[model samples]
Target: METKFLVSLMFLQAIINGVNLLRPPDQHGSKCSKNGDLNSNVLLKSRDVALDELYKSFRLPFTGAQRSNNGGIWAHALCPPKEKMEECRECVKDTIDFLKKDCPKQKEGATWSIFPHFYCMVRYADHPNQGNLAEWAWVQFNAPPGPGNATAGELEKAWNNLANTIMEKATEVKNLERYGYGSVLYGPHPQNLYGTMHCAPIIYQM
Candidate 1:
């Protein structure tokens, strides 16, 4: 079934001429349920089992996990195609720690983080169809005005072109990697503008 609620933390970063143009308003970008059902031992058991399996199965750049039985928990994790094994594991571990603290009672959670060496995402839900785009929520980060004399119109045009190209390329990606990246020239100074995108390896519906 489709997941009913979603909690996601997405980070976006844009750099130009050694200056960061995009930053998250909330560094944590954490979302959690206000009230937790701590006394629900069944749910707690399912959550623990699901998380354990997720960590164990998180070998590939993209992976998914589900409880051995129908405990109603499913999880997915992702790292950049070129991410190192140790770095990806560390990122996932840190992300899982954040979810355990910030979403203590939550049935589902997702987080995206980009580090200097690697980037990753961890998502878990009680529903099986977590791959469905309709079950996802998004947070947008707006970049500040272009540095120097570049107008908003010019910036938007360059960004749109780059974004569109990246998205299309991402769709064309095949096999398990499912990632795409590109860069373009921008502004009067002609600094480089870069973009990247990824899609889940597979989708399941129930």
Candidate 2:
């Protein structure tokens, strides 16, 4: 019963995170075509279809990228490491809905959202492999709310150390999903800090 209750809590948290993490399109810049170009229309249509397929059938705890026929559109979706299948589905659903609303006319777009249990990413573009993190056009996020019992300098130092560790561990593994997540305790209060890093499979190959 405890396990079931925990799962229920996670689901609720995921829904809340989906809503709270959404950001404005301008903060990430617009990649959508402005001139109503015919190719852009085709690409948009294809992207929509690809996103639908991915939402319908993607493996949990992994990253998947799909391309439309004739390669006019590409889309990618990723769930947080070790996410449950149902949670992953919900995350992808939320991500798709958010993208459509936030990037209504964009030819390319991407978003990263933090859910209570995990995080998810969704992106699409007119060209293939646009989901590659190294090639992503934008990265935006507010700083962590407040320093938790630690000085600003201590928090920065801890964050840098955690980030570097995650990166090193993520890259050391040559796999389809090269990502890592872990926690560390630091400072006089020994507050626990969590971090995660990921690169799309294509990015690893490149």
lDDT for each candidate structure:
0.54, 0.54
> Over 4 Å off in model 1, which ranges?
1-28, 32-39, 60-70, 134-136, 140-146, 173-175
lDDT of 1 at 86: 64
Per-residue lDDT for 91-194 in model 2, tens only? Answer: 67777777777777766776666555456667666667443333234444553443346777877677667666666666675644565655666666676666
**What lDDT score goes with residue 72 in model 1?**
72
What's the TM-score of every candidate structure?
0.69, 0.67
Q: Candidate 1's residue-wise lDDT over 110-160, tens digit each?
A: 665545435566666666766554323343434455445666787777767
Report how far residue 175 has shifted in candidate 2, in Å: 5.1
Q: Model 1: clashing residue pairs?
A: none
Candidate 2 Cα errors over 4 Å, as ranges: 1-39, 59-71, 131-149, 174-176, 203-206
TM-score winner: 1
User: In candidate 2, residue 200 scores what lDDT?
Assistant: 54
